[model samples]
Target: MPPGVVSMAEALANVNPDALHSTQTGYVLPEPALFVTSTLQRQRMFLHHWKLLADGFLYMLGQEPQLLRPQDWRAVLEGKMSGYGRTAGLQELIRPALALCDIQTIQGLPVPVDALPQFSLRATQEIIWEVADTSFRFEFCALDKRASGKQWVAAGWAAMALDERHRYVLRTAALMLDWTTHCTRSNTIHRVADRCPWPPSEMQALETAVCEYYTTAFYEYFGRAAVIPMRLDHDAEMEDMEDGEI
Candidate 1:
């Protein structure tokens, strides 16, 4: 045995087989005294032991159906293990049964949607918003107070008006915000915002360039920015990047 691995016999001994059996099959199958350990190796041993128990349960159902009863088999097949209920852990134990029998294709037993993990739209939106807000704040600090205040107001309105359905557009805007913020922070040639003499038109041009760069990034990440609605489009100065334009 490896340093971090336990044997199947050892794992089976620690846990009550009756409890394990009851969790898997409605009826208490069998119990025997066993040894147990609290090591990472025990996880491997546990999985292997579970495989043996699942195999034996199926075999019993085939040979002595009367002993197990039909409802008990139905509960197992439907992922409704006794004490475990219909949890992911129980589902893992029953994977063999799911594979052996085409439980999915069978008329009434649809797989549970929550059984699989999925990416969340809300979480993605929150990330985009964080990136956008950070970028806006960083860039706003580079301008004179009056212009900075106006830009701050505009940025806040833009963030507030952002539509949940247009996350891709929000992502593009965030990328542009990051680019402008980085450029402003790194430009040592100009005096700091309080003393800098850069005019409003120059600042506006810089913002325009950032928007252009954002369009290129958007096209590279997603095939086309035009797929997003016209109302959400910000880079009006540049032509839309068609498919394969990158």
Candidate 2:
């Protein structure tokens, strides 16, 4: 009931004990998984199961994408990317993408990504969209010989859904008014972009996608709507899954 934090007991109380196991058939069941942060710890069990498909047809011989760069995505989910790191606010979050796009701004603009947020939004777009699709629910249930590739894809959306700061900044960016974005300190400025890089609907969709997967994860792992402590055997299973040996 708190503003930001949801305790495990509160999270559990929301889940229906008698709900059908939806992992087998997907989470189209009546009782949906609670969309809260309580799944944060439990979801780690399937952190290895996250992934994406490139161009909708880039999957080769059924091989999934590799998690080449997971540092930024991992750091935030683990609560490591919040404070000042080289740049203040969320500038650190979008710094890597800036380099990729060759878009150089001042040394430390208050929110460089704020001006054109797509540079940051594109970081997690395709992969999150894929994993959230119902098709991969079973794939996550199975892992190939390479599993690390999908971590960042899942991590990208999880950061948006789970981290308070990350979600707040993203939602704020989406709600920015046209005048607000174009204005100077005092007077209104000339025209900016005809439209923002990305739309608010994208933010809503990302949250919806992750929240659905968050619920599906509970059913897939716990076999019930409940989220309890994962056992040692499950931990070992997750370790093995991470190695793509599963």
Candidate 3:
């Protein structure tokens, strides 16, 4: 394997945490930021690896990695065992997962909204607020009723792609982990709060508070920014890359 595929711990040890935190929108992140950055770097590395493995694995597996069939399990296992596979044409797969990730990386998120068994209308509204809270508008959008959900789906992926700032936050946070104690079992919410910039110990509580705060402020900001009377349209003008509109 090439050196770039090395474990994240080995790849980004010398990265400057202070630089990453400062480089962001003037937020003084805690030490945990390093681990976040490392995680993101690893994801990018894996994404590249996925693309690289596409061809050989597709030929061997007899299908594209992104569209594996039930019978394709054997090939998947074989590829893993052999350390070869690819992720070509995986942007469709990548966008949804990465969008959730970008949000978690920047905002110090909890459970993914998509992972929920179902979404309340209010919950969906809240999610949009959180997405906009970071002002990374392109990361979240709704499907227009006229487009029959197509526009929203496309917009959703586009939003994730256009979110450059969110990506930077993810890369930065990956570096702050001790790698040993960042998990929920190791550190409680209060512990994180006491030691880190944002605190209160329970991870769930932190997630909840952050979500509530962002959601509230996000709607308020949107209300203030609105020029004309408009209903809350989640997925509007998502079909094309409308600059400065997001």
Choose the strongest candidate by TM-score.
Answer: 2
- The digit string of per-residue lDDT tens for model 1 on 149-237 reads 23332232123233432332223233333332211222322222233344444543433333443333323322222111112123323
lDDT of each model, Cα atoms only?
0.31, 0.29, 0.26
lDDT score of residue 110 within candidate 2:
27
Task: Compare candidates 1 and 3 on lDDT and give the better one.
Answer: 1
Q: Per-residue lDDT for 1-246 in model 3, tens only?
A: 111111222213323343221211111111111111234333233233323333343233222223233223222212232222442333333233334333222122222434223323433333333323322222122111121323332222122222342332222232212222211222232344244443223434443332222222222322211110012234433433234221
Which stretches of candidate 2 lie above 4 Å from their native place? 1-17, 22-154, 157-198, 224-246
Candidate 2 structure quality by residue, lDDT tens digits, 177-242:
111111111111111123344354554444333233334344434354422211121222243232
Instruction: Evaluate model 3: give its lDDT.
Output: 0.26
TM-score, cand. 3 vs. native: 0.17
The worst-scoring run of ten residues by lDDT in candidate 1 lies at: 27-36
The Cα RMSD in angstroms, rounded to one decimal, for candidate 1 relative to the true structure is 24.6
Per-residue error at 114 for model 1, in Å? 40
TM-score of each: 0.18, 0.20, 0.17
